[model samples]
Structure formats: structure tokens, C-alpha cells
Target: MSDQHQASASVSAARALPQLGAWVPGYVLRIAYAVTAAIAALLQFPLGSWLYLALLVALVGALRPRTLAPWFFLAMTGLSMLWAPPNTHSAAFFALLALGHLTHVFAARMLAVPARARLQLRSLARPLLHFAVIQATTQLLAVLVAVLLPGSSGASAVPLIGVIAALALLALAFVLITPLLRHERRDERR
Candidate 1:
């Protein structure tokens, strides 16, 4: 083959590879986010209609993280729990907790960074720590509540517990985000 033709072919191949690679990470993250959201929703609702709704919400949220779609998915998941039968299974509860947390984390990260951007393990350390703290606190609260209200059917307390948990999470988020907001303001002033 002529040298010019060979060089052009090699250049095209190189460009093609990176284009393919760039597409993979974004698609993978989106798919993962959608699946996690769907599972979390189904875990709470577990009905066919709910599954379709969840998937639609998840897809929209995954594709447009900056929109209110993610929040809608979260609200849907939370509301579904209201109608769920009294869940005594600690394992299922914990799984749902983790999955929900994951869904939120993935959505938040996708909002902050482009889907095609590669992430390092170290970048996720802070999120992992936050998850650990929240999970521990929640599990402890669950245990305390279970012990304190052994006679209760547990349905009545679910909303109250959910409210408390949501408040705690919101407080934590505020604490974590304050410094970032300050930094951004400082940058703007400069």
C-alpha cells in the first residue's frame, strides 16, 4: 500500500477507536442508573405498571440529569412504600435503602459530570463514606424504632420515619454542599 494511504487508514482507525471508547462509558453509566432506579422502584412497588413507570422515569432521569425527572423518580419510589405491606424483612429494607442511595448518587454524579468523562476510584471515596454514615445511622434508627414499638403494625410509623430520614439527609446534603457553594461564590467574585 502507498505510504499516504497507509497513514490515512491508521489515522482513521485511531480516531474511530476513541470515538467508540467515548461512547461506552456514557452509555454504561446511563444504563446502570436506569437499572438501579428501576430495581429500587420495583422493590418498593413490584407491580407491572409500576415497573413501566419506573423505567420511563429512570430513562428520562438518566438522559437528563439536570431536570426534575430524577426527583420525580425518587418521589415515586418513596410514595410507593406508603402502600407497601408492612415490611418486616430487614434484608429487603436494607437493600432498598442501599439501592435508593445508589440511585441518588448516580444521578447526582451524572449531573455534575459528563457521562463520557472517566471517574477514578478515589473520586468516589467521599460518596462512599457518606453512604456508610447514612446507612449506619438509618439502620440504627430502624432498630431503635423496632424495639420501641414492638406492638405496632409498623404501617403508621413508616411516614414519620421517612420524614425524619428525609430531613436528616437534607441536612447532611446542606452541610456537604455549603463549602462548595462558598467556593463558587468566591470564584465568581474574583
Candidate 2:
């Protein structure tokens, strides 16, 4: 065939292939969640048998972010915290925080939008800002806590403080996100 004819034929063949734009984002997010979960699990229990269970949970959660699987995965990770050895390194802790938050955010996004829907980067600005704010606040609090109580003797209060911090973060999230959600609902009704 002539070059132009061959080029057109190849273009037509490419067009015949299934469009995978939708599948790409969904699967990429799912895989990212699973990988983050696995890493978080490894961070918590480096050499334990529970790693397998965590991996399974992560896979399930990644597959069904709209269901309770994500919650189950979070709960499993939380439980691991109770028995895991103390980690004094702030960097590792921050990494864990980021991983958990990103996993949750990914799951929430999957739940909120259809996999086939196109998302604009501008739509992510607000959420990204919120995430930054949360991370910054948490990191500041962590530094303060570390500075105020610099020994293992004060470690007992760490868990309590963590729970309180989590509750506060949840409240902050609700306050920050509820208005947007309500607006979306109203738009849908309209």
C-alpha cells in the first residue's frame, strides 16, 4: 500500500481498539492503593505473618473502595499499631501518614465519581490544598509533641493524643468538605 494509505489504515485499526481511558485511572488508583497498603503493612509489621492478611485486605479494599473493605483495611492497620514497636523516626511516621491518607483519598475519590468520568486537574485543587493543610497541621503537632515530651516515659500518652488528633482531623475534614458535597447534591437535584 502507499505510505498515506498504510498510515490511514493503521489509524483506523487503532481507532477500532477499545478506548481504555476510563479503565486507566480506575485501575491505576486501585493499584496505587494496594501498593500503599502493602507498604504501610510492611512498615507496621516488617517480619510478621499478618503481612499476608494485610495484603489481602489491601487487595480487597482496592477492588471495592465503595464498600466496607477500605474501612476493614484501615481497622487492620490501626490494630497493628497497638502491637507494633515504637517508631521514633519522624520521617517514617510522616511517610506512613501520607500513605494512609493517600489510600483513603483514593478510595473516597473512586467512591465519589464513576470510573468512566473524566476529571479535570482544576477539580483537584481544593482537595489537594485541604490535604496539604492537614498534613502541615499534623506534622506541626507531631513536632510539638516530640519536643514537649522527649522520652519513652511519656510514650503512654502518645496513643491517646493520636486518637484525639484523629478525631479532630475528622471534624476538620467534615467541616471543610461538607459544603462542597452539599453544593454538589443541590446541583444534582437541579
Candidate 3:
């Protein structure tokens, strides 16, 4: 980044939203969701192997969301095996999911956004909240519907519940960050 752009980005970040350590924007959560979807899709038996290979390629090269999405769905067709899946495998599953989500955010910020160097985390607050609410609502409804459906054993449901809980907590923490920073700034003024 040029010195001029760097200067402007800090200014924009300061103006747009509060910083959370490194000025990570709220929309990072959207990237997180996109990544999570890919990972969830990858948790399959045969298809997962391909998605994993694709992820490696994307990491070394550029990632176009369009290119990767179809594979995610294709791999996701294998998810039927999860309906009565075992809980013993959840730890690795959730770990990979989180990693995938973080990787997407990192890729978007570092590679896709040309002006990323000047972008502030604070600028994304409103949109982040808006999308987050939508994601949460739909996710909750899915959970409810899944519960209503037959053949949805507790073992399979538990992992999904855990994934939802983890994501919710992460988003909640990020949501709280903006207000907390604002309050801190106010206190500093006083």
C-alpha cells in the first residue's frame, strides 16, 4: 500500500467504525459464513476430498467465489450421511469449519479487496448487523424444521447445534465490540 492510501485507510477506519485490535470489519462475518458453508459441504465422505484439494489450490492462488460454490454444493450432496452421524467426530469437524471461515475472511481482505489496505473494520457495522440477523433467523428456522423432521437423530443434530452456537457466540462478541469501543471513547473524553 502507498503511504497516501495507508494514511487515508486509517482515517477512514477511524471515521467509519471502531477498531477491534486490527480494525477487522464486521462484514468479515459474511466471509465467515461463506467459508463455513464451504466447509460444511466438505464434511462429506468422497466429495470432501475434492473440496480439500480445491481449498489448497485457492490458498496458493486467487479464489473466485463463483468457481468454488458449485463444488461446495456437489460435495454437500454427501451430507445425507450426517443425519445419524456420530458425535465422536464433531471436534475435528468444527475445527475445520472455523479454519475455513477464517481463511475466507483473510483471502477477501488480503486478495480480493484492492483497497483493503485502507479499509476499516468500523465501516461495515450496519451491513454486518443486517446480514447477521438474516443469517441467524434462517439458521434458527432450519434448526426448528430439522427438529420437526423425522429420522433426524440427536447425534446428528448435536453437531449442527454446536456449530450454530459457536457462530452465534462469535457474532455476538463482534456485535458487542462496537458499542464497547464507543463507550470507551466516550469515557476517555470525560
Best model per TM-score: 1
Query: CA shift at 144, candidate 2, in angstroms?
Result: 1.6
- C-alpha lDDT of all candidate models, in order: 0.76, 0.73, 0.51
For candidate 2, report its TM-score. Answer: 0.68
Which 10 residues in a row give candidate 2 its minimum summed lDDT?
17-26
Tens-place lDDT digits, model 2, residues 1-190:
7999999999999889554433344456666678888888887666757788788888888877778888788888776665554454546666777777777777777676565565544555687788889888877776677668767533556687878877998999999999999999999999
Q: Residues 1-190, candidate 3: write the lDDT tens digits.
A: 9999999999998889544454554344435544554564455334556566554544332334335543444334324434436433344443443444444444444444442244466655655565467556644554554556456334555557657866999999999898999999999999
For 26-108, candidate 1 gives per-residue lDDT tens digits of: 44556777889978876777668877888788889988888999889988876777667456445676677778878888887
Model 2 steric clash pairs: none
Can you rank all candidates by lDDT, best first?
1, 2, 3
| TM-score: the better of candidates 1 and 3 | 1
Off by over 4 Å in 1: 1-27, 165-190
Candidate order by TM-score, highest to lowest?
1, 2, 3
Per-residue lDDT of 58 in model 2: 84
**What overall lDDT, based on C-alpha atoms, would model 2 receive against the true structure?**
0.73
Estimate the lDDT of model 1.
0.76
